[model samples]
Target chain A: MAKILVVDDSNFQRNQILRAIKDDGYEIFTAENGKIGFDLFEEHSPDCILTDLNMPELDGLGLLKLIREKNTDVPVIVLSSDTQELTAEKCKNLGATDFMNKPFKKDQLKAVLEKVFQ
Target chain B: MILTPDQEDAIKEFINIGAGHAAGALSELTESHVKLSIPAIKVVKLADLEKEDDSFTKEISSSVRINFKGFTDGTAALVFPPASALKLVSLVSDEEFGTPDMDSVQAGILTEIGNIILNHILGAIGNIFQQHLEYNVANYVEGEIIKLIEPDDSTPDLVIMIIDTQFNLKDLEITGDVVIFFKLGSLTKFVEAVENVLS
Candidate 1:
């Protein structure tokens, strides 16, 4: 089973993502912000990470850079409401595996996870 | 409202950046081309919102409202006339609905859209200005603007920055207003940020 870490500031958005993937059998760790998320990444060494871009303390880009320092192979998918092509490009340049815009469908998220795990 | 002409222009430039990014997010979500027209912004008392725009105050509308406070304190809302809200939800869900009334499911979808768009706009402002903001959960409400956005009791004379944003998606044009009602004291801080950016 793949261990996945999910990080976001909004409880509602986190719950929505959890509800979408709860039945998928992935062992999940959750954090409310990127700092806690990076700490969880260090402890659990999850196979993949899904994170929101804007957060207090530490942001998604910051977390991605932190994760890359420790492990470059683990897939880090960035979820953001920022639709700027430059944002996606910046994530790519920073080693993010994928970028999905927020308000994404459940199936869309699930499919992306499936592709990542496969 | 005490801003100089240069300061006001700077504020509008910030708002346009935020709205442009939000429009891009909407376009991606709906898989359509979305263009944002230059936003028309005005400052008015909360009581005078009806006098400012008929589409927002007079028509039946659906809105998602979020309250946030940090470097600046205020309420922000994405207001859509009923038909436009219904059309947008339909476009997202690939469903056909004859009525302008949105069901729970449709409202949920609209709330999500609003959350994304509003977040993008606010997030841009926060990032560009380096302000830390904490947001209340997004709320979906329907009906008149007065009912949707209640005036703050503590600040009886709340000033509102009404940003009229028009989203042009493919052939259909949808109009929504991003209304940010700044608390009395906080407006100064926001203006200061604008001036700081200028200097």
Candidate 2:
């Protein structure tokens, strides 16, 4: 079982997130969008998920809600370019673990994952 | 809407800055020197834009679009030419060209690239303007290009269309768009920021 599930519509971002977390020795599974992400989530039940807010089909928020409905405890961190406080608040209210602005630092990703998985 | 002289200059300057940032980010990611030229900015009636040679349609056969509301109400999109998109996937994946599936992988790469480029541009705008903006969910579609442009109910406003021409060190051309919807009032502020930064 992978410890992390990196979900986004972008290969570059998925790769960047995967590269950042690979050193933690956690198996990583990736999905292109929310629909596939949810399917993978059900199958692998990863400890944490890093997702992009803007994605085709089911978006990050929709995926977050779906994942919460199935297993509310899994950490779902939103990664998006939209930095409005309202978006962050909405994600938090919907049971997201945290929100990280896009183009995040390497240490920030590790720190957030540690906080959630610890 | 015809922009004042100051607004035109500001708009150009704003795009120039945004393009510069995008170039830096692409260079870092690709590890190849990348150069981006200032996109020719234009403000034409929607009807006029639709009738112009249909180059955008030919360039992007399929796309996924997302409309961002708040601060600015405009549509942003991710458009991919089939062959060029496939080339990008091959470049990023280091996979041998052996009939790899195109649909899912192509969608994945384009969506990610669009996400990065759009985010970088929007983030730069937010930084310069000192306002926070939020993005809506991305909607995927594969069909005629005309379907991408629907009438916005948010009162007709200025549409800022930026055509990104990316060139790697070897002159590999990766083309994309950064379209922003601007409300009239905020459009003034945006223009001011452009002028301030440029002048």
Strongest candidate by DockQ: 2
Lowest summed lDDT over 10 consecutive residues: which window, candidate 2 chain B? Answer: B153-162
lDDT of 2 at A23: 80
Docking outcome class, model 1: incorrect
**Per-residue CA lDDT of candidate 2, range B43-121, in tens?**
5444455555535644445565666554555666656555555666566555645663366765665555555656566
Residue-level lDDT of model 1, residues B1-199, one tens digit each, is 5567787777788888877777777776678888976556777776666576457768778999878788899888999988888888887666799776788878877877888888888877887787667666577888877665554533447777878888888688888888787877788899888777788
Among the numbered candidates, top lDDT falls to: 1
Off by over 4 Å in 1: A1-118, B150-155
For model 1, the DockQ equals 0.17
DockQ (C-alpha based) per candidate is 0.17, 0.31
Which digits, one per residue and each the tens of the lDDT, describe model 2 over residues A28-78? 999988999999998988888888887778899899989888756988899
TM-score of chain A of each: 0.97, 0.95
Any runs in candidate 2 off by more than 4 Å, and if so which? A1-16, A27-51, A55-78, A82-118, B50-54, B57-64, B78-81, B96-102, B139-144, B151-164, B180-199
- Name the best candidate (by TM-score): 1
